[model samples]
Target: MSRRGWVLFLAMSVIWGIPYLLIKVAVDEVSPETLVFLRCLIGAALLLPWTIARGQLRPVLRHWKALLLFTVLEMAGPWFLIAYAEQTLSSSLTGLLVAGVPFVAALAALLLGEEERLTPVRLLGMAIGVVGIGVLLGLDVDGAQLLPLLAIGLVLVGYATGPLVVTRALPDVPGTAASSIALFVTAVVYTPFALPQLDGTGQVSAPAWWSLAALGVLCTAIGLALFFALIREVGPQRALVITFVNPAVAVLLGVWLLGEPFTLGIALGLPLVLVGCVLATRRSPARTEPSELADVDSAVP
Candidate 1:
């Protein structure tokens, strides 16, 4: 990677990482659905105009079925679940749990008929990743609620399924148009829900509003553009490596800024999961990275 690639890489690392903290702040006062709606709405408003001006937006509609599926799996489901789970789980712990995205994504690829060259190291890596999950749940903090953890489990599956839809099902759709459609359709779907609460006193906090703005403008909208740029600069495979760094940034922000604890579980599980991800995904001919957006968007919250 060149100097510019390093800049994009570092920028994306922080850009994708901080969403966990931002979501934590926004959801403190706002409902999860409203947060998702506002975030996606801002992203679509910023991105769609360019796609339309360039006449690339219309072609994406032809793949609307797959596009819709990708939206539901990637943004709709995972984003909401992350918001909801952040209500209970520490931003740091939530980010750590998401590090296991590769475990589910590997399965999604094989199940979706991607011919990945699965090897012994990959299987062992998957095993180590699972054990790391157990460790995170076991050692770090005991009193965390089970329901939120289960919600995150669903989020993992949804996030894992999204990339396959983008990589295989919607191959003809350009990245920007595909992402614009995803955001726009999602915003439209949640319009009935988010519209009613826009003026609610529940979401009037200054930090909450600023967090929402950053999530939309910096994380979701601008982050997508940079991600594609990173892909162009370094190539898609290398761009995806940012996934490994995002959790660390999430954990650091959660601890340093949010005053969340750095528990033993995080201390122990973080490396195990990351190493497992590297071993599981390295040289595999499949898109199993946690931040598997097919060069279209940031990894996650």
Candidate 2:
């Protein structure tokens, strides 16, 4: 990676890493649906001008179907689910659950007949990753509730679908344009539910509002821009490496900022899940091309 790539990579890791904490803060006072709506609305408002300046808005509007699917799958659904889950689950636990996204994406690729082939080594890696997750869950199981686990599962499913959606449905569209359109559509879709919650008393605190602003401007807008740049530069498979780093950030933030407990289970389970991800998605010597989307879609709460 070049200097720019490294910059984008680190920026994405940190920006994305903070969103779980931010969501935790915002959702303390706001509804999940409302948070999703605000995130999309603010993110879209920030990006809309750029889309217009680049003359990409018209093209995005033209590809409304792809935009809609990407919005629902990538943005609205997962965002709400993560927020809902975080009410019960810690940010670290949510991040750990999301670590499985690449494996899910790889499985989707194999099932969908994409370029990647699942070798035995990859299979073993996947198994190890699963075991690691199991270990983590066993350790954290006492702290985790059932509904939160279910929500985390939904987040994993949504995260997994993101790459497939980008590669298969919206491949021709530039990621920035695609993401911008998706955010815009997500804002529109979330309006009905979000509107009802936007009353005066429902307003969030200053810090929470700042967190949402960061979620939109820094996390969603800038993070997605850097993520797309990374995919274009390093390819998606390598870019997915950010997932490994994101969990650590989430765990740290959860413990340090949110006062969520950091247990031996998380300490042990985190590496296992990350290692499993490495094994499952590691590029073989013969493999050349990188994935286009970089699988950063695991921005679950």
Scanning candidate 1 in windows of ten residues, the lowest lDDT window is 289-298
Q: lDDT by residue for model 2 over 16-36, one digit each (tens)?
A: 788888988888888888889
lDDT of 1 by residue, 1-301 (tens): 8999999999999999999999998888998989999999999999999899999877878877888899898888889889999998899899888888878888777777764657899899989988888999998656657889999999888877777777777765667677888899989998898888887945378999899999999998899888877877887778868888998999999999999988888888988888887777666555544333453322455
Q: Candidate 2: TM-score?
A: 0.92
Candidate 2, residue 38: the lDDT equals 87
Off by over 4 Å in 2: 142-144, 201-203, 288-291, 294-301
Q: Count the backbone clashes (under 3 Å) in each candidate.
A: 0, 1
Report the number of the highest-lDDT candidate.
Answer: 1
lDDT of each: 0.83, 0.78
Q: Which lDDT value does model 2 have at 63?
A: 64
Decoy 1 TM-score against native = 0.93
Which residue pairs show backbone clashes in model 1? none
